[model samples]
Target: MPVPSAPGGAAGPATPPAPHITRRGLALAGLATAQFMVVLDSSIVNVALPSIRRGLDLTPAQLSWVVDGYLVAFAGLLLLGGRLADVFGRRAVLLGGLTAFAAASALCALAPNGPVLVGARIAQGAAGAVMAPAALSIVMTLFPDGPDRARALGVWGGVSGAGGIAGVLLGGVLSQTLGWPWIFVINVPVALAVGAVVLVSVRPFPAAGGSFDIAGAVTVTLAMAGLALGVVMGSDAGWTAPVTPAALVLGLAALAAFVALERRAARPLVPLRVLARPRLAVANTIMLLLGATAAGLFYFLPQYQQNVLGMSPLTTSLTQLPIALTITAGGLLAPRVAAVLGVRLALTTALAWLAVGLAWLARADPHARFLDGLLGPFLLIGAGLGTAFVYVTTLAVAGSAPGETGLVSGLVNTARQMGGAVGLAALVALATATGTPAGTGTPAGHQPNLTAAFLGAAALAATALLLSLTSALHHPAPTAASPLLPGQRTST
Candidate 1:
């Protein structure tokens, strides 16, 4: 089969290429698998946290590190990874990242101590940063048409949305039946298999030549790590702690330095011009808020199930099916909704749904029933999240130059990860500060803290809604001539 030419005839192949299982379809598959793995890792360890804590003899802070390590590395390195993919070949970087991720997963499964486990988690996250951008770039390159790309993205979004819920369910089942290690162990074979598929199916695209921005990379990485660590530690140590204040200060300083460096660097990690676009900037802000709100809700929901509802880990995981299934359903339906309602209308509606869902969750009590109180809210949350993801993602990627697609995608995803880390930390801090005892393994008192967390999440969702509304009103719809990276290319 002949390879399809890239946009503007800057490629090595001809048009009307013979379809061998359609390049678009295969590209979508590869991207979806990457997204699934990344999303799955996010919460897969939650159900096994107790087992891990017991087996590793971890303190609460150490246990938190198991999750935090991954977020820090993944979020910190994402921009660099995306630039690397653009400089090198996306396929090469993707396969390498997959191999590294598989090895790291194996190491995690074999870890004998908390430190080792945390280190392995960090390696896995770094590999994820590399893999994610390459995967999205493959999709962007393969599906150049608007309609085709939209459809492919809907499937991609569905996989990502479903993967989060599936992680909890799979983790619960694996931990109960096999052991916590299996949760990590399972990634090895899956990663290897996906690596093989990516190697075989993805065609080589031309590399965009550029030197890595080492200074920008270092500063941004430190900034992200500092910010994430500050929030995570603040939850346990109190916001007034010297360590928390120091971390926040250091993070802010580093970020400011990064901005200054980018303004001067010949090849910046993230071009400052890209950030100048109102639509992209606003969209990313909304993405960050939505991410934080979603993570906060997912993190605490299991606590309510296990502590308040008296559910087993397995049952708690099962109860999240309403969220998983609805997210998948909504993701699959998002493109159609976007087509019918337009991006602005769809986005506004989704945000409204999220607000309502969060408010409903805030009303939960110790006596709340699953069907009446939890199920509907979960379903609504999932649906709203699913729809919002499509719009936000589309806006993030829509008008970028070909060379900058990976960077744009990586930045958007990085925002999501950072948001999740900060959001989770903030909610936990609120629970701790309000002196609302998060039930010492009891039923009655646990619900109030969780409810408070959900209320905080609602406020975050409202913030996102406000931003989305402003973006819709002020920014015009992006056209094909617009650069994918913000301000990187001007309208023709």
Candidate 2:
């Protein structure tokens, strides 16, 4: 029998709610494993692109589809997935998504051609969209509703943050030692295992009774799809392309309508009050900036290392190992850092690292030494990115009402996805705008090319920093926006 407790109690096992996963050790393992598999798929296929292309007889454009398809579907439907998890039941939806994800992985592994692979990846990404937010929301329920949750989130961030880098490493090992298909095949067993664990370990979440906002779901899904399409197509088709502007307008209009409709809906997919919270708002905005600048950082750095500095692809990939490790280290350090330097200062310092690091990288000369020139900024970037992502994510979810976890989680994630697409697209355009002259020296042309992009990324980080200098990040006492830190107590 369930132990009856006061609403919003802050005790150990019943932090906010009684999590059947015990609100402790083994449950966290289940959540983290599920998180890893969902996040790993985002980048696992990148290293296998060449092999996939040859094996599937895919055109460059078709190969691009393999990635873009997944991204669009994942980013577009995240909020819907989150809402479903919260409204229906987290455990049920999570298990369902894991099952679908494993099945999709199987389809991807066995795909015979480009179309099949693209379709399977899209399905896989959609399943991930469902799984990611639900798993995260469950994390919220698993820890005590105070400093414990904050610290646990740090661990969660470390595992989640490392997924992309881990994918690159794993993809290389699996694809080379086995085949390109192994990248997806590996997920099948992992997802199945995660699913089995959740089923056996987790107690069912009661459906939060609510009227289905079917109309709201449709509008937002279309809105996100349109916006993602605009950004994704803007690079290839030109920003002025008919499809791009049309999609943008459609998305913006639908978004506006969705907001207006939500304000009046009996049960909105996302409540308007949640959007009104300053801390949540700024946190998600910072998350967007983090994702954008990070996209530019990763997109350009490896190119500079290989093309300008003359390093082997294998060597360049291996070099990033330090960055990946540093990222995980930073994630683990975030709660401690936030404890010492208040959240705002910590976040500001993290952004400063990005601005300063990227700005430093802009001065990279053609003959620059790897250890002295690149390693510092890479470490700084890795740590800064690690810290920023963890803190921003924590703040993003800090002040959620009982049933709003999935909504907020989805919102922050959607911001990250869209930001990355937009950031990388804009940077690519800037890099390509001034085409390399036929006789330009490698040093002269490549140096400036990479420098300009790095400087732009620095400027973007700086802008975000400037924007971050506000009251939202500061909380001498926990506000309704953020009352879940160690010393903090939840107010009902």
Candidate 3:
């Protein structure tokens, strides 16, 4: 539409190209901010759970629902949400999602009962599911497959993860100083501010126009909701409870139906071919384990520090600064490690690091000190989380077809959310069974309960490590013609 470049690649030797690149960079900043806020919600409420429980008269199990409920809706709707972004336009979807999320946060803040708070959390999660993939898809749309895209993703991934750890620390300060309601109230201003920036900076992406898959969306959403409910209630209501079995059966049946529908749908929500890829399958499984273990550890760690150790919320939050910093460092180094060691080897090493950290924490004694007992494990976990998230996400979308990027992003995130929901449910049950639900008991009894949960998380990491080793045996032979994984600096 404009003049061609002159001989020296100057734009007609007078007018420069439109400031498209700068616009893209600005857009990336807006998207990354939205992503950071979405991820922060997943953990920010954790430290506030005790305050909410006291204010609203919530049981320990009900408190778990506040976090898990968000996860359930997010995981369930992610695929459909991604598709909708393609249909509705990325900027439109993201703005809409941010609006909904902000409103939900207000709802959560104003709720006087546990049920209302949990419901609001679910609304926030669903909106986040829409926002996250749409935001990332915008990244892919704006940045070409090169160093630019890679760098943007690196910043995106790092900020997304740092939000999770930072939430624990921030939650403590807000709950301690401003009261628990401030945690949710804080989201309103941030979300609105980010939305305003995005509106002004980011242009709308053309919709990946298609007929919506109504049946697929409905069934899968129902399946994930049922599964999350079953998992949560399975522990609380006992495995043999009639409702638990019914929910489990209903969830599985709906899942089967969703699969059957997808196989025949004219425009499927998730293509079977994508799911069948061997490398993607393994990578997602590893992500699931990593997500689950991390969620479990975060869930219990604060309870131990506050309940057993009698630490104030501010002090407890400060303890996690080391984790946040190390995760940032780990993210910076992940690309280099992947270039040198290959994806499988690098991921395995990261998993091993996580396992070591968890095992170290598992050895805690009844009267342990934080510096001697917890700091080392937190460092290891942060490093592992930082590196694993980068590489695993790269692997998940490595070979995707052009239009399928949003779908894969949604699937990858769904794995993490589902893993967190299920893992937290299981660990919550374990802690209850071990002793009085995350050490809400005598000081002497607290350490053992937390130790059991930490060991369980360690075991999950080890399992992922074992899977990574098995996958290494099946690596394809590298050749001169082989393609490097997407955006990797090398062919390793």
Q: Which candidate is the best by TM-score?
A: 3
**Each candidate's root-mean-square deviation in Å?**
6.0, 6.5, 7.1
Residue 240 Cα positional deviation in candidate 3, in Å, after optimal superposition: 2.9
Candidate 2 is scored at a TM of 0.78
Ranking by lDDT: 3, 1, 2
Residue-wise lDDT of candidate 1 within 1-492, one digit each (tens)? 000001111111222223322455665676688768877887787767766866787744566568767876777777777677778877788888899999999999999999999999989888988887677666755665567767876677567766777797997798878888999998988888887777667666668776888799779777876776687667667778999989898889999999999999997877889877787788788888887787677666765666666666787778777777777677667777777676667787889898899899889887788888788888788889877876776777776675555456556766777676666666766755553455566433322366778889999988988887774433554556543222322111
Q: Which regions of candidate 1 deviate over 4 angstroms?
A: 1-32, 50-61, 139-158, 198-209, 396-407, 435-448, 471-473, 480-492
Q: Local distance difference test, per candidate?
A: 0.72, 0.69, 0.73
Backbone clashes for every candidate come to 7, 1, 0
Comparing 1 and 3 on TM-score, the stronger one = 3
Model 3 alpha-carbon miss at residue 2, Å: 45
Off by over 4 Å in 3: 1-26, 144-151, 203-208, 398-406, 437-448, 477-492
Query: 38-141, model 3: which lDDT tens digit per residue?
Result: 87887687777666877897765677788877877787777667677778877788899999999999999999999999999889888887887777666666
Instruction: For candidate 2, write residues 139-213 as lDDT tens digits.
Output: 776666678787777667657666757775776677667888999999988888887777777788877755567
